[model samples]
Every structure is written in C-alpha cells, then in structure tokens.
Target: MYSSPEQGGLLLSSLCLLSSLLLNTPLCYGGKILVYPVEGSHWVNMKVLIEELYDRGHNITVVRTSTSPYIAEKSPMYTSITIQNDIVFHDFFDSFIEMQIKAQREGASALTFLKLTKDFLSMIGEAHYLSCKVVSQMLDDKEQVKRLQEAEYDLLLTDPAITVGLVLARYLNLPVVLNVRWIASGEGHFAIAPSPLSYIPVSGSGFTDKMTFIQRIQNMLFKSIIMFQQNFVVGPIYEAMCTKYFKDGCDIISLLQEADIWLMRSDFVFDFPRPTMPNVVYIGGFQCKPAQPLPADLEEFVQGAGEHGVVIMSLGTLVNKLPADMTDQIASVFAKLPQKVIWRHLGKPPSTLGNNTLLVNWMPQKDLLGHPQTRAFVAHGGTNGIQEAIYHGTPVLGIPLFFDQYDNLLRLQERGAAKILELAKVNGPSFEQALNQVLTQTSYRENIQRLSSLHRDQPIKPMDSALFWLEYVIRHRGASHLRTSANRMPWYSYHSVDVFLLLLAAGGSVLLTTGLLIRFFWRTCQNSKNKIKKH
Candidate 1:
C-alpha cells in the first residue's frame, strides 16, 4: 500500500531532525574524507580543507579529477589519492571543435557556438530524462557499487561538477557531501551562494510587483529553462558520459539527488536571506596557502598604497578576452582615480597612465584581500570574487560580463556590499565614478564588514558542518532524515493551487445554483397558495 503524502512528509521531517541532532552530538569516530576536484578553484580549496582535516586527525583520501594538471604543483600532504579519469566525450569534442572552427573562420561570435552547444546538451539531458529506465539499468552495476564499498570512506565529498559521485554515494555505506563550486540550486541542497534567482519571484516592471497572467507564466517558463540548462544540459551531459565510461550504471542526477550535505564555498554573511536546507554549510573563503612568497616588487606595490592605497581590479580568467577599447577605457578610468590601483590586467597597459595606477599580469588574490589597506574591488562579480571580497570586508564595484555574474552583482548591490556597472555601458567616466563611489562610501565598507562578522560567527565553519553531517549519515546508515520536503509529494501535488482553485470554483457554482432554485420554488409556491385562497 502506498503511504499518504502527509505520512511521507512527516517521516522525512522526523528523519531530518533526528539526523541533525545526531550530527551535532560528538562521536568518537572521525572517518576519512574523500574529496573530488574538477577545476582549478576546486583543487585550491579542497587542498586547504583536506590539509585542515588531516591536521585535525581525520584520514583523507582523494578521488581527484585527472584533468587538472595543477594538482602536481600542490604541496605534499599525508592524504591518500586516487585520481579518476575525466569523462571526455570524443564525439562531443569533434562536434564542438568543428563548430568552434566554423565560428572562428566566419567571424561569427563564439557565443553563437556556445548557444548551440548548450541547446544540444540540453536535448541530450532531456533524452536521459526520458531514458530514466536505461539510467536505472546502469546504476545497478555491481562492480561500480563494489568500488564505492571498497573505498570504505566514512564520508564522501565531491565538487558539484561530477554528480555521478552522488549516485555512487547512495549505494555505499557512507555519508555524502556536495562541495558546490558556484551558485547552488536544484541539487536540492544549500551551499555558499544560494539560488538568488530561484527564490525571487520576478514580477515585471519598475514599481508595482504584480505580474500579469501571461507574464507570470513567462517568468516560470524562463526560470524553468534556466534550471533545465543547469540540471539537464550541463549537469546531465557530464553524468551521462561518466556513467557510460565508468560503466557505473548510475546516472549523475541520481547521485546528486542522494547527497546528504552541501558545503558551499561561500561566506553566508555576504549572501543574505539564503535558502536553508538541513545539512548545507557555507565555507567560501578557504584557499590553499600560496606556494611562493610574494615578490618584493609586488609587496612593495601593495604596501605603497598605504593610506588610500589599493584598488584591486581583475576580470577573472574566463572574461579576460576583453576588447582593446574596453581595456583602454578601464586604464583611462583608473588614471582618474585618487587612490593607488593594483590592476591585474592581462593585456598591455594603456599608453596614458596616472602615476597612482599600477598594472600587471596577475596578483595573489587571497593575499591581496588579506591586506588591510585594500579598500575596494573592481571585479567581474564571479562567485569566488564576491565571497573573497566579503570575507576581507571589502566593498566592490562590479562590472559584470555574463552568466551568474549578473545575478551575483545584483545580490551584492541589493545587500549594499557592492555597486554595479553594466558591461554594455561601462566607460571611463562611469567606471571612474563607480570606483570612487565604492572607495569613498562609508556605508559600503560598514555593510560588508557587518556581514563578514556574521559569517565568521556561525556555530560551525561550513567545512566542518559539512563533514559532521556526512559522517552522521554514514553512522546512521544513510540517516535518510535530510531528504527534501518536496520529495514527499508528487509534482502535481506540490503545485496544489490548480487543484485548490478547481475545487473552489465547483463548490461555489453548486452553492449558488442551489440557492437560486430554492428562491424560485418558494416564490412559485407562495403565488399558487394566494391564487387558491382567492378562488
């Protein structure tokens, strides 16, 4: 017999509460933490966390991505390692590269190719959804299950990139934590940057908040598209490939769905009104200690910016392909600033420069943030950049380019931690004013500092909380308590407004018709009686 949705909800809620309580209680056993890093930042943060955990006497075993050559440069750690081969699709490589060549030759934007790739991947994602049966078959592979069993990890930790790990986690007798590398969403978990876009109901227009019927539908549709792109397109394509190559039989989505905890690499103080899940934690500021000492010249550059010293400007790695005009505009803007600027401009410096501005290829970002005189940040508003600025209690002037950067800056501006200069409109005059506004404003400084303090004051550092919760699940045999409230109900049932309105309309119509019939019959009877008495 199927359990009522209410009972399921109650069961899930009870499980979550019990698991949370158990996790909070100290236990004698602290098991090994298995970490997976797919990107450069992941490698950096995971190394820091693993070392910290190892220092605290936890055994660390790493299931790292083979693609990252940067791991070889890492400092020696006592942790055990098993590097998994990255799942690269040969067909996808051929197709994407061909498209890239065509776009390059035609002078068509790479953005167009990106769109096509995204759409193709999204369709593939949908295919996986439709082929859930095939996924179910793959996940049933016993050999893959045995690998997880053999790892004997007390807890499994993975970056959000390889969601297939999540599926493996479900079969293994260990607690699982997802380390989010970016803004967190439908992972059905919390991380550093909660889905700001997910929660905010985007009603149209400048002033009033009401959305027209059509607009409301459109909003939901658009939001669904975005969610689909993340969950189905990028995420699924990765998982499908992993399942095929690993022969693990487990689809990535299934793995992601099974995660018990979320370690958001973010400072919660920076992100306000975050969506809370049972086991999610924010620890965004963690980074591996830099290998080399800052060069004397770089140190001198930073130190020289004593009183009105540092304005750190960096567009991050991805968006460094800026046009010459934009680069010139940035240099021109910095020349006008009163404070000394330390710029990580990958391109050559503009011919015209004020003595206060210093441009270079790169700077140690975390070290720069640690500096006391570092007043304001000029950033692309990447998630990592935003959290670092917040952790250091520095405000920002965000010149967002694309993707999550737009949403990231919007939240920062809303929180009074930063100001926004749209990519399309940024020029010397506006850029200079933005920098001045961020650097001079007392409120921005105060606001970000207050948030940083709150973030630091959490009962547990996000990393520890993530570890604790994962172990709790393992100890409790997959605590099963932390499942989402949404999982208890079907999709239709979760969206109950349609059912509610339908019932209300039917009941109202019935009541009104009954009342009208009664009135008509009573009048007819009275009229008949009067006629009879007169006769």
Candidate 2:
C-alpha cells in the first residue's frame, strides 16, 4: 500500500525521534557529587548508586572513616577523604550481633523482645553518639572544611543510617539527597510522612497495613518506643552536635525533613502502601539487575543438580555464623534435600554435613539467584537479599535474625512467597519441614513470580528513576518545593488540633452565653409576676 505524502512525513518524523532516543543517552551533563555513606550493608546498597553515577561521567568523592571495613581508601570509581573514626563500625556491629545471638538462644518472649529492644537502642545510641563526635571532628578540621567548601559540589547523597551526613550537608549548604530507608529515629517515613498507627505498622511490630484493634494497640506501643528512642536517646546526640556546629539552633528531624530528595530503598512491591511525600521517591529494587555469568566451578556444580536445581542460602553480611548447634541442625536439613545446596556458612563444619551441600565462605548471591537452576533462596530476610530474590522470582525460606529481618520476611510470607521459622523454634525436623514446604508449594514460586512481574513492569527501572530524580535535583538545585510545609508545622498545627480546639472553644462560649441569658430572663419574669400578684 502506498502512503500519502502527509503520512510519509509523519512516519519519517517518528523514525527520527526513535533514532535520537536509542542513539543518545538521557543523562548527559555530569555534575560533581559528594557521598556520605554508612558502613556495612548500607555501603553495599549505596555502592550501586555511586558506580552508576560514576559511569554517567560525574565526579564522585566519598567521605569515609579511617577504620572502615568495606569502603576502601582507594577506589577507581571515586576519590576518598579518610577521616578519623571515633568508633569502628566493624567492631561495634560484631559485638552487637553476638549479643543478639545470645539473646535469641535464651528464648523468644515478651520480656526477651523488650530486652532486645533496650539493648538494640543502647547499641544504637552509642554508635550515634560516637558518630556525632566524628562529625564534630570533621567540621573542626578547618582544612578539610575549607576543601569541601571550595569544591562546591552540587549535592550530598547519604544513607542517613548514621545521620552525620545530614549535619555535614547542612554545614556545606548543599542540596541533600538521601539514599535512605532508615534514620536514627526509625523508618524514614514516620519522621516526614503521616503514619497512622491504625494502618502503617511500626517496623518491628510485625503487623501489616491491615491491623486488628489489638494489633493497633501493639503498633502504637512500638511507635511510642521509637519516639522514646528518638527523643531521649539518639536525638540529643545530634542535637548537641547541631548546637556546637551552628550558632543558630537546629533540630535533627528538621534537617532530615528538609532533605531535597528521599531515594527510598522501597517500593509498593516490597513495602506496604502508605502515605508518602512528594520528595520521597520509591526505588525499591534499584540495586537489582540481570545476573552476570557465574564462575566456572559454580556453574558446573549448579549443573550437577540437573533436574532438582539449587537452593542457595546466605545469612547476609552482619552475622558471621549461627550458634553451633543451630548450624548443625540446618546442615542436617540440607543433607536430606535432593536439590544441590550452596550454603554461605563461615562456622566450623557441621557434624551432620552432607555431600550434596557446598559450604562456601561466600557465593555470588545475585548471579546465583538469577540462574535458572536456582529453586529457592534460604535467606535471613535482609532488604537487599529479599529484593534480589523477588527480582529473580525466587521463593524465600526466611530465618530472620535480629532487627527488621522478621518484618522484611513478613512481607514475603504475607504474599505467600515465603515461610518464616523462628530462631527458637528451628530444630532439625522443623527446618527440614519448612524447606520442603517452600520447595513443594507451587503457589510460593507462582506468587513470587507475579511480584517479579509487577516489580519489573515499571515505566522506568528503579535505578534510572533514582538517577533522574538525583540529576533533576542537581539541575534545579534543592527541591524545597516538593518538601511539605508539615515539616515546619508544630505537632498541634500539623494535625490541626489548634483549629479543632478553636472551634470547640467558640461553640462552648455561645452555649454558656445562651444559658446565662435564659436564666436571667426566667428570674426577671418570676419577679415581675410576683410584683403584679402583690399589687
């Protein structure tokens, strides 16, 4: 069929546009970025972003501690400014993990939960206090402060887990972008967004968005605990830092609320739906991508399983080894499974060790999860691992240990994509049973696959979306317009309690005036009636 001239011109235009899109990159102009990342797993999450920004032709400078375990002093992607660490994160978390393991081994109970919460808060407070000192030291360094000021970077991208970055950004007067899911207070949402205890569950509450009356009470109690931790424990440390640094008073929460963008490490696919702000961008699985080629030996081992496939297990970076007896129990379960097992265990070999299981110090987790031979992921329910599992459509057999792991796993269990076993309840038989159920249940695989589909079906990939928002901020300076006025409002004003109270007072005044007037008229009429009767 021959097209008309007008139609031909339109076709030509469309083709030219397509060519322009495919041939040219979207992020062209590069800008200098200053990164303030937290140590440990948070660094792992932030690294993906730094690398992407680096490849896009941006100059990256990292501020790290002298004793940092993960973020090296030298890197090809970014320059580093190594500063003295008041507290070494590696040692701090190591001891914290040991305490957690000991607590779990004691037993799980209400008291145990509260005690752990207390201990967790204590550790958190110490870390934060030390971090505040570090920031103080950084600012006190006139030479380094001058260096940072002279560089005149476009923005500061931070994890805010430590939150020293917030103060640093404030001092530099740079546009702040947070690669955040957590702050010292709690989950990032509670501080900036409207979080109703009725639906939005506290991080450790284990309640989903739909809460029962009793569950809501429990959530409220948990929320109060977070408030206590924030106000009494962590808040003061940063507040003091703010006081010392700025002659003008500063509130830590205000600094966080004033951030230009929140590149939230969450999306609706993983996190439950809740009220959020305009500056908060959801990029849940931004770090996830197609798996690269596996190492030769790992591929051959995966192939050996043939029809049975592979079950990959890792407890994440924080926990080095499980309790000795618990390790033995888990190893026994792996021994019986027909599927080839790749267990990332650093502990001594279990007495019940089996030939079918490959015990490695570490494995290529992302690549292994993406492989077709992978059947299910045995994980500790860290956000990164769970998101990766969802990305690869792998069902989870979650052994949640400490902090928000249970909550992370709960999301999967709620979706029928996972099974959760308690630390105290995980005997050899129970471990075997849970593993079998995850493997045999067709629905587990199907449900996670559906989530994978949903997560994948987005207008833009999470990474790209995050980058666009970041560059958007750089191009336009701070995104204060997207920030809500509620941040500046006092508690009473924010909830409009003042307005409600004002209306109530007005109503009460009118009622009081009417009642007094009626009483006065009744008395006057009675007096007049008496006088008339007397006459």
The numbered model that scores best in lDDT is 2
Q: Write the per-residue lDDT of candidate 1 for residues 1-535, one digit (tens) a residue.
A: 3379889888889999999999987673666666555444445666667666676667766553334444652445544343344433333434543453344335435587457546555444543343333323434667755665676777777676535445444545457776774422332332222344434333111111234666556656655655666664656555665555455554444456556666666554544354666655556654512224457887787687667778888877544345577678887877776668888876566766678888778788877876776888888887777877776778989876544566667667877888988765677788878888888879999988876776567676665665565556656755457666664466577679779888999999999999999999999999999999999
lDDT for residue 193 in candidate 2, whole number 0-100: 92
Summarize candidate 2's per-residue lDDT along 309-423 as a digit string, tens digits.
9999999998888888888988888988899999998968899889999999989999999999999999999999999999999999999887889999999999999999887
Error of 2 at 423 (Å): 0.9
Please count the clashing residue pairs in each candidate, in the order shown.
Answer: 11, 0
Worst 10 residues of 1 by lDDT: 200-209
List candidate 2 segments past 4 Å from native: 1-4, 11-28, 524-535
**Model 1: lDDT of residue 78:** 41
The 0-to-1 C-alpha lDDT of every candidate, in the order given, reads 0.62, 0.91
